[model samples]
Target chain A: MTDLYESQRAMRAMRRAAIQRGVVAILDVGTSKVACLILRFDGTEHVLAGDGIGAMAGQTKFRVIGAATTRSRGVELGESCAIQETERAIRTAVQAAQKMANVRVDHVIACLSGGQPRSYGLAGTVLVDGDVVREHDVARALASCEVPDIGPGREVLHAQPVNFALDHRSGLIDPRGQIGQRLACDMHMLTADTAVLENLIYCLKRCDLELAGLASSAYVSGMSALVEDEQELGAACIDMGGGTTGLSIFIKKHMIYADAVRLGGDHVTQDISKGLQVSMSVAERIKTFHGGVVATGMDDRDLIEVGGETGDWEHDRRTVSRAELIGIMRPRVEEILEEVRARLDAAGFEYLPSQQIVLTGGASQIPGLDGLAPKILGQGVRIGRPLRVQGLPQATTGAAFASAVGLCLFAAHPQDEWWDFEMPIDHGAARSFKRAVRWFRDNW
Target chain B: MRPMKDPAPSRMAYRMNRLMLTPRFRLFLRYGLPVLLIVAGVSIWASDEARRDALAERVAELRRQVEERPEFMVRMMVVETGSPEIEAEVRDILPVDFPVSSFDLELDTLREAVEEIDAVASASVQIRGGGVLAVTVVERVPVAVWRRATGLVLVDAEGHRVQPLDARADRLDLPLILGAGAGAEVAEALEIIEAAAPVTERFRALRRMGERRWDVLLDRDQIIMLPEDDAVTAMKRVMALDHAQDLLARDIVAIDFRNPRRPVLRLSDAAMQENLTTRTRVYEAVVE
Candidate 1:
């Protein structure tokens, strides 16, 4: 745990250094594709002191200079399975982006969509050290939280203080400088499998990129796809990626719970391949062109050629109705949505004030998923796309790039984490030395 | 089925592409490498002393070819002088062969050399049309003739010697000045001669007395010694005395106006003797 903490701190410092360099690359190592977006910080000169922290947030300060996406290889469910192959894929995407941006980026902020993310809610309380609660008290309160046993091979990805309470008044955003007997903080800590993170790190290292920060793709997708009102009034974002369906719950602009089901668009493609007796690539094409849920009579009449290269004449000229393609794609998508619904129900997402569910990612582009999602995942289910960022190419402004775009925003202004605050014990020796001096002075 | 090739780059290719994209390396490849190559090539070619010397010799030969072109060649010299003697003197002093390149001519130094001639006051040298080296000289006008103990020489008003004279009578139109250092004050001598114009008929020459004052010698052996300060004014005073009193016509052989307040005149021998005899006769008659 301490090792991971130190590594996380190192990563945080690296992120600061990368931002100082004014150029950082956003790498989304998804299951189906690896997308690299090079962002150049244009400076915060136009961000008026307090104005930009509102609706626009920090997204105005950076512009996407280059973007490239390549078909992922040797990665399963967002975990790097084959080291060299994944490195090659990352190199291809990064090289293309570097070519486009005409700059060499040394630091990269990457997102992972798999690794079995688990969220833990922890509440810690500490007595106020002085008459008024100070920043150190908030740090002490956060540090006092009981770390749950996240298992032997999992590491904390994010530990954010979601709420602060001063004495009896709960729901305080910041408890510092408030007169209170006790300061309490509710922190949301997300931990993921350590092996998955190590694999991703190794791949990035092979590509000559420094891991400045690593985030769960589900959290970042929520940051990008969920509207401000939805995030503030409570909502759930389901990122139906190629290899995993990730869901994150947000309330008061803070992600309180995040989980991913190891099932996504790739599974649907697999299902189509199996049901229609076509190649995986061809099935993917058919799915993208004609795949949908909640099929109508018109889909039954429309036919798609699911051809093959086999020498057999009938096999080469095989065709399937659009309704048949939908019949093959809908069940898998429904199973992924049902799994996401189960994860949200277990997370108590229904208790939030708003039950807005936003579905995004490459898989969410299925034609009739929006019409079919509310039935399984409950009401307020809308297909969501990533927010428009400056200098983004027209071709990349689709639902598939939600996490990639969110990584850009996350790189700009990351939410405060537990490690951002200095540990109170860091100043222990100095404080003791001063105490010794004060004791001598009082006696003399 | 022919297997589909992997779209991913090989590790070597990827590393090479990244190395090429490094901004510093790219800039070096684009600009620094070419400059370095050219410099290295030239240095290697020039490393031998013989090669360096050959290159220098070739450059000099090229320069010589350009300089010796017909357009820049000066075929002959033209001296514009007031007299043929002066022109011949100038041509003899400058001993340059004909058909020399103008680039080989130092015009400023040649002009200085030409102006050093006694008869030449100022000169300018230039290469003009038809490949002619044109030397234009302004000849000094000899204002007076000065007779030195060594010889007679024509001197200008500013007292610069122009040429030698064979005899005093050879330039009678010019007033003759004599004595050491008289050439330096020819201007003052000319002014005094102008003041004594009324007695010009008797004026023989003006001699510098003590190299400070002037002594005017007239043809009848009359001599006027003038004061050093305002010698021209004293000459003018003597002229005024001659106009009013016919002073030059008298038997006075020398008039001393060195002290202008007191004029002293020395008469000739017969005039003095007749004056003494006349005085004696008048005394004897008075006794009877």
Candidate 2:
């Protein structure tokens, strides 16, 4: 736990220094594609004083100078399966973006879609020392939270204070200068597989780049894909990518739960390939151009030729109806959605004040996803696109680029986390005892 | 929800919460900005046009403050190697205001201005210690007095006019040159005058005739026409003959040394009559 806290602190300091130097790169290492974006900061202090009052305060002035996306290689189920091939893919994407931006970047903040992220809601309370509650008291309250062991092979990714209460006054975002005797904090900590993170760090080191910051793609996808009100009230972002479907739940502008399903669009593609007896590349092309989960009566009349390069002309000229293609695609998408629904149910998302569900990512572009998502994932489901940013190319501003664009925003203005504060060093033993008690209170 | 003692307090809290939640308030906080900023920007841009002018003046004032430090100020100007009169004229032509910053003064331009004066041969300007502006001038010295049709002008060895002389006796120590192109030929004329220094009192002036050659005018209206190529040598020889045999003291009116091999001397009337009597007696003796 100390090692994890120390590394998080070191990364936060590095990120701050990088931001001060004016330019940083955001790389989204996803299952199907690798995207890189170069963001240039103007070093304006407007963000420091505004705090959480406005979302645009910190995001008003950054520009994307370069962006590049390439087909991911040697990555299976959103994790690197082959080191050399993944390194080459990363180098190609980063070099192309550097060429476009005309700058050599050393610091990069990366996001990954794998790693099996798990979110925990930990609550802590502390006694205010003086008549007024100060920043250190809030830090003490956050430090008092009992961080679960989360097993041996996982590390904490994000530990952010989601809500605060001072004495009888609840729903206080910042209780500083308030007259309170007891301060309480509700923190949301997300942890991921440790080996997956270590693999990414090793890959970045091999490429001669420094990892200044890291975030789970599910958390960032909800940040960019959901609207402000959806995030502020309650919502969930389901990012269906090539090999993984990421789920993130947000309430009061904080992500409280994140999970991923291994089944995704690639499963549907494989199903089509096997069912139609076509090559993988042709299946991908047909899926992109003609595949859909929802079919109409007219789809039966439409025919798509599945081309093959065999010497037999008749065998190469096989045709399939659009209905048959939909038939192959719908079940897999339904299965992925069912898995997502199970995760949402397990997270107690139905009890939230607003159960809005936003569906986004490359695979969410199926013709009738908006119509089918609500029926399967409950009501208030909408297809979410990434928010429009300055200088974004028209082609790159789609559901597919949500994680990359969100990574840019996250690089610019990261939410303050528990590790950002200074904790008292003398009360380690007492703090541990209190943390154990709270752990029991939270679990049993 | 806790109940408020009065509706006013609860209503105030509700209004504050509602205001904080409004998108307009968020925009106002993010970019629409503090009212002070808008007021400052609009007031600066929309007020009297003199605001911009005042801003420029303020910038210039700040630059002046930085540039006018004690080390950069030129407190005194010292002129070296110039006569009192030339130094005064140098001061007049130099474009510098005393006690001004040296950065404001262009030393190259000052040097050029000082050299433009007729008496200044060359000049250099530099900044010395103790806030001093040192100007060194090499004044042109008068070597000959040119007698022009208008007046007498003192000219240097290079035939550049140094100053205007009031009278011929004002600079009697300098040699006198006469004619249209005498100023340009002052060097050769001075050479001839030096060669004829033995008859310094009898030498009146060197005249440049037809823009070439020299005619030496002596005290008794005797004109010695020297050839152009070896005029200096001819003058030397004439001076030598006059010194050895008192050839110039005799009753000769003119000597034509244009053809050096055949020198001709034109005699006075009395000497011509004596020469006729002597030639008749010599002729009778030769015939007998």
Candidate 3:
């Protein structure tokens, strides 16, 4: 835990240095595409209240100066499988973005969508040290939370204190300067496979970039896709990416639970390729152009040309009906949503006041998804695009770039995590020092 | 469907691209490099002594071509003055050749040289339009002719020497002040001459005595010695006395008013003998 704290703190310091330089690159190493956005932080100013413009969740502080995307080569399920190939893809995206922005960015904030992220809810309480609760009491209460055994080869990615309760009053976002006998906080910690993280860091290193920060794509996409009210009430953002469908549960504007399912749009593409006996690229084109979840009578009449260059005249000309294509994709997408529903059920998402589910990412663009999603994942499901940002190109303002856009917002204003707080002096090395002092007092 | 080939830049190309994107390096490539190349090329070309000398020679030749244009050439000289002799003297002293470029002329030094002439009070030298060098001179008017031991020289009222005179008859209208250092007191001598207007027919010259006082030399060997401090007043008193008593016609060879309180006269030799005989007869008459 201390080691995680030190490294996360170091990353925070690196992020500070990057923001001081005013330019940072946002790299979303998704399975479908490795997207890079060069963000130039121009500092923040308060907007006038009654002018129909709000704070915009701190997104106004930075502008997306350069954006580029390349076909993901060696990344599978958001983890780099082949180091050199992943480095080449990253180099391609970063070089393109740098050329567009005309600046060299050394610091990068990246997100991963794989690694089987697990969420843990931790609660701890401490007595107020003074008449009014101070920041020190909050840090003490946060430190008093017992760390759960996250198993070997798993690293803590984010540990945010979601809620604070002062005495009888619960759901207090900030407990400082409040009269309370006991200060309690519920913290949400998400951890992922350490090996996957190492691979991502190694790839970024190979591309000559310093890893300033790392975030889960599920949490980031939730930040970008879900509206303020959905986040404030309760919502689950299901990012239907290529190799994985990442889902994160947000309540009171905080991600309380996050999980990823391995079966995704790529599986559907593979299914189409197998069902129609076509190439993977052809299936991908067929999926993007004519893919649907609900098969109507018109869809049955629609036929998509899946051309091939096998040099055999009969083999080259093959066509599949849109109903058949929908037939191939619906099962996979249903399976993914069912898996997300199961995860959300296990997370007790239905118990929340508003159980809104937002489906986003590259695969979520399948037509008739909204009509098909509520059957498996329950009602209140909607297809969501990322929030519009300043200077973003029209081509990139899609569901697929949600994580990339969220990374921009993240770089502008990062939420405080457990590592962002000062560790209570009574823990770790400070305890040993206190022990030594006690021993000296006894001897004297 | 297009081929699924992954395209990426080579490592060296990527590094080079990033290097080119660096702000400092880009600025250097955009501005500094071109300026540096130009300066280096110029310096390298100028490194050879012969080439540098050729360049300098070219510049000098261009300047000479511009200077020697017909419009810039001073073809002749003109002197604006009241006296022709002074103009000739100015032309002689300057000694400038015609059809020379005005650029080659130093007008200020020429003006200083012209002002060095004795009769020229002030001078200005300029090259006028139509290829002419005009020299304007202000000539001094001689107020007195000083009879120095060397010769008589025309001197201005301020006692500045104008020029040498061959003889006194050359400027008879000007008064003569004769003696050592008399040129310096020409103004005072002229004042004394003005005061002795009543004895103008007898006035021959005003001679400086002992370099401090003046002696008015009249015709018929008569002289009036005037005091130094107010010699003009002494001359005026003498003029008044001569007007009332016809003092200049008396048989007195010299009158001394150097003391100013007493007027002393020295009689001529025959006049003294006649004065003694007259005095003896008057004494004999008085005794009988």
Candidate DockQ values, in order, are: 0.58, 0.01, 0.61
Per-residue C-alpha lDDT of model 3 across residues B152-203, encoded as one tens digit per residue: 8999988999999998898889888899989898888889999988878878
- A1-444: candidate 3 lDDT, tens digit per residue: 889999999998888888778899999998989999999987657433433212323334788899999999887877779889888999999999998898999999999999999999999999887569877788898998888999999999999999999989999887878898989999999999999999999988987899999999999999999999999999999999999999999999999999999978889999999998888988898889888889999987898888877787887787778989988888988889888889999999999999999999999999899998999988899999999999999999999999999888777767778887788877767788877887887699
By summed lDDT, the worst window of 10 consecutive residues in model 1 chain A runs over: A51-60
Q: How do the residues A1-444 of candidate 2 rate in per-residue lDDT, one tens digit apiece?
A: 677778988887777767766667888988888898888877465655645432332434688888888888778788888876677677767766776776666689999888888889999999986689877788789988987779989888999898999888888877778897999999999988888888888877766677889999988999999999999999999999888999999998888889999977888889999999988888999999999988999999999999876667887899999999999999889899999999999999999999999999999999988778888898899999999877777878999999999888788768778887777643667778877776888699
Model 1 lDDT tens row, A336-355: 98888888899998899999
Ranking by TM-score: 3, 1, 2
Cα deviation of A125 in candidate 3 (Å)?
A: 4.3
Backbone clashes per model, in order? 1, 0, 0
lDDT tens digits, residues B1-288, model 1? 889888788888888888897888999999999999999999999999999999999999999999999999999998887799989988988868888998999999888889889989899999998899999999999999999888999999889999999988889899989899899999899999999888777789999977988899998788999988898888888888888998889898899989988879899999999999999999999999
RMSD in Å for all candidates: 4.9, 26.2, 5.3
On DockQ, the candidate that comes out on top is 3
Docking class of 3: medium
Two-chain DockQ for model 3: 0.61
lDDT of 3 at A274: 95
Weakest lDDT window of 10 consecutive positions for candidate 2 chain A: A50-59
Highest TM-score: which candidate? 3
Question: Residue A324, candidate 2: how far off, in angstroms?
Answer: 0.6
State the displacement of the C-alpha of residue A298, model 1, in Å, after optimal TM-score superposition: 11
Candidate 3 Cα outliers beyond 4 Å, as residue runs: A1-24, A40-44, A47-65, A98-107, A124-155, A177-182, A205-212, A274-277, A290-307, A310-331, A418-444, B1-6, B16-27, B178-181, B202-288
